[model samples]
Target: MTFFAPRDAETSLHCPDCGTRLHIARSCREVHMYCPACRAHYPLREYIHRADEAMERFLENVYCDRIE
Candidate 1:
């Protein structure tokens, strides 16, 4: 099963390959951009500049867990 953070529709992040909207998804240890239509995963560093509210929320949770 895929684990994705809640998406923010106002975020305009899109897949580089298919132009589909990207979602914030996490694996066992990391979070990144995921394109459901293209089934592609992109590293956060590559898209951090374009991050929106959803990505920000996901990152906050990730770091909070690590700190505690």
Candidate 2:
């Protein structure tokens, strides 16, 4: 069974390897993402972490710009 946050449901997912659309597979503690185009399989946790970091950096930049 696959469970995703409501926010994730709204965004499109793509494979990092082949630029193909990714579909979520079984989900428990970690979610599996598969790329049919490239036969790539990986966990979504890493991608979520990366996205969180990027968002934090972007927010920091925006805050700095506002203060300046």
Per-candidate local distance difference test: 0.68, 0.48
Candidate achieving the largest TM-score? 1
Q: Over 4 Å off in model 1, which ranges? A: 1-11, 64-68
Over the stretch 1-68, how does candidate 1's per-residue lDDT look in tens digits? 97655432223698889998887776667767778888888877787777787677667656433221
Error of 2 at 20 (Å): 0.4
Judge candidate 2 against the unseen true structure and give its global Cα lDDT, from 0 to 1. 0.48
- State every prediction's TM-score relative to the real structure: 0.70, 0.44
lDDT of 1: 0.68
Pairs in steric clash, model 1: none
Can you tell me which runs of candidate 2 are displaced by over 4 Å? 1-11, 27-30, 49-68
Pick out the ten consecutive residues of candidate 2 with the lowest summed lDDT.
Answer: 59-68
- Backbone clash pairs for candidate 2 read none
Error (Å) of candidate 1 at residue 33 is 0.9
